[model samples]
Target chain A: MAGASFGYDPRRPVLRGIDMLVPRGRVVAIMGGSGCGKTTILRLVGGQLRPQEGSVRVDGQSVPDLGRDGLFALRRRIGMLFQFGALFTDMSVYENVAFPIREHTDLDESLIRDLVLMKLHAVGLRGAAQLYPNELSGGMARRVALARAIALDPTLVLYDEPFAGLDPISLGVVGQLIRQLNDALGITSVIVTHDVYESLKIVDYLYFVSAGRIVAHGTPDEVRRSTDPFVRQFVDGEPDGPVAFHYPARPYAEDFGIRAS
Target chain B: MTSVATGLRRVGAGTLRAIARVGFAARFFVAVVLQTPAALRRIQLTAREIYFAGVLSLVVIMVSGLFVGMVLGLQGYDVLVKYGAGDSLGIFVGLSLVRELGPVVAGLLFASRAGSAITAEIGLMKTTEQLSAMEMMAVDPLARIVAPRFWGGVIAMPLLAALFSAMGVFGAYLVGVRLIGVDDGTFWGNMQASIDFWPDITNGIVKSIVFGMAVSLIAVFEGYDAHPTAEGVSAATTRTVVGASLAILALDFVLTVFMFRGLGNT
Candidate 1:
């Protein structure tokens, strides 16, 4: 994406003058505070949203310029894991993994069944294939979503907060799987997350955004050793930094109705 | 004077918003219709919706139909007996059920049951991001989800209405002839002679179909347009029920006025 700017309301832009890139066969992570337009970037890439200015191109094709058929064709080559799994509750694990294949191909049920099982096996959840999403633990559900995301073996996979709301063990497991999957499938991965430590461990490159602008971009080692206050605050997990812990407010004394002492 | 001007402005703004909402709903309805062919190509999806929207509501519709019919029979008998026309009780119950109560009441029940269910399901799906997930997978949620439910209601509405009318006539028979001592022959003979297939039965079916379209369209549109939150889904479900009910009654009145306009001349 180059100079991408977008907002649900045009007058209040959520992303402004953004440029980011994901090279082939690499893992990149974009980190930011809540509501900083991280997920909006993912939507622009998937063509779920169009940037108001500048271009979002994937594999030499501009996303916003594509018609319905073209956009769908482009999306076929991209997979996304939402904040939660977002698995179809009505479908079983095996069926969830099989959905894209069934919708995109004319493979027989027998062939689809084998592909679904293989994907489930890759996620180490083959035994849980018949289980519904609601029946799985949060970690296990995210794993199933990982399997579903790679079912088509796309060139690119986007992860939106892949480690949110997880126990430590689950978080480690997910972080490892993301790295392992990127190498194994030779697929480029772009993750949007605020999990600083985990992303530092796996990602080849990092982009730190603040209030819709890229404040810092570096390799993980540079990010850790750098003196940039924003990067320091994020890496050190400080209570207050360039981004204040407190929202803008009136004077404390006035808020409490206390006269000056 | 300033306050009154503000009030007038508020009213004008509300009217414009309402009109804009209606326009958006009309466009959504058209999109659903455009996707109907794709929905029908995979008939099982629509069949599943019919089971949810129509088959599931059967017991309520039938029971309500029966109770309404029994009351009509008792009331019609009381009124006719005063004029020494007690034999006309079956005709009264049959006409009222077939022409008005069956479609209107069945529609009201369906709006509360099936229409609300559709909205809640779709709204919940939105809340959970399943619809967004589908879109990201390059699957159009409109074709895969909304169109099937829309067509299912359209196909099932008239059938349910017919069933309601049938059950109602049976209930009337039980009350008017079996209990009230009206001659069975006179009851049957009178109903058969007075009820016309085109004017009464067909017109009723037509009304039910229109009600079905209105209810289904409102339900799907509300669901598709719901805010992606629990409270939003709840509010959308409430709107579906209320909006569908109002649409059914208002459409029924307009249809009745047109369909039975020739009653005085006849």
Candidate 2:
């Protein structure tokens, strides 16, 4: 394990029982196929949902036991980029980003405006402040969501599927932006995505999750060389490996032009 | 974990949810009762919503109320003639309109009209992820979004109910004096003396408040649970109206029974 170990359990284990301590100010990416519960891991860290059997802690405050305000305070230090950017469609982009700063602080309007502008500028969308969320492209929406996420100068940023449904150009821009923001802001980031090739090129560390378990954890090259069958399937994007789409391995030899034994 | 600890946790969570639901309702009334015009930015948005709610639906409400009043006058006069109390026709129509028909019909109408409106608006917000975004930014939707509608309903219901009651009386007066050939002075005099008691008026006002609370609660509840899909929003809207309508009838029945038995309104 290369990052902080998440709590493991029998009754309700998170998608992975990863035991790797994520160093502060480093960018870590958890790469996995869809439905592997990558988002659950991030949510557990974000203090939204509690693991039924184990403890999740943020800054040493146990998530399962946190009061509402305590959980909110803990969340203030972390920013999350939800799928499709999750911008408030009812509000303009300016209001969306300003929302976090306003709720978490009593910063006066003038100071809040300056901070919101600074955040939007970081995402390179400051000019789009007056625009509604519906006007933005997918990549731009994700960027705006990123801006809102980092509004409070969060210490940790959790990005869920940043490169999902993105064009290669947009993908590269998002990847570069994620890395640049992490470095420039000196913030730790956990990117959850299935974009193995793109994420591998940028992430400092990688964890592969499959079947509610961590199959491999290490640097990009290390994980790329792992002998596990699921790891091989994920990294190589192979259709016929240990990761079978169909349930039950009983008819195991039906695919790959092989007969069942 | 021990079973007792687990049980305690379950109880605690249930209690918290109940508290939140109740708190949600109280916050709605508080916002309405204490609304200031200077909450302008938010109020501007909410006022547009209220216009569509309270004003735009006026035509249908008035039309519907018109028919109800006409029918009440016809029926009351016929029933009074049978009792050999035809001269007291105004009293029966007035009392029934004031204490019985006014609040209940308006409530049912509001549940169909504005109750569904709130549900649909909130449900759309839910489907668009607007509500979730608010939460992520630490905005309490209950306080900012829901409370005003609840209180506005409380304020509006009484006005609408009073209008409905008054319209019915006018219809009764027309039927008694012109159609049924009763004297105009006798009709008005009987109505003034028989109905319009202070107690009856108080009961009508209280019933309007209760109806407002019911409609707002059902609408907000549906909107809050609306899933992030078109189908979900449609279902939420339908449920809000139907559920609120049934709840209104039940509440009307309870209020009618309580007022007649204890308050001596019947």
lDDT of 1 by residue, A145-230 (tens): 99988988899999999999999999999999999999999999999999999999999999999888999999999999999999
* Residue-by-residue lDDT tens digits, candidate 2, A1-261: 223234355454445455545678888988777877788788777765666545666666776688778776777788888877878776899998998887668899999999999999988999999999999999999899999989988898889899999999889988999999999989999999999988888899987777667777888888777877777788888976767767665554565569546
Task: Quote the TM-score that chain A achieves in each candidate.
Answer: 0.97, 0.87
The C-alpha stretches of model 1 lying farther than 4 A from their native spots are A257-261, B1-13, B262-266
Best by TM-score: 1
Q: What is the lDDT of residue A244 in candidate 2?
A: 73
lDDT by residue for model 2 (B177-211), tens: 88878889888898787665567888888888898
- How many clashes in candidate 1? 0
Clashes of each: 0, 9
Error of 1 at A47 (Å): 1.1
* Model 2 pairs whose backbones collide: A3-A20, A3-A21, A4-A20, A4-A21, A4-A22, A5-A18, A5-A19, A5-A20, B28-B147
Candidate 1 residue pairs that clash? none
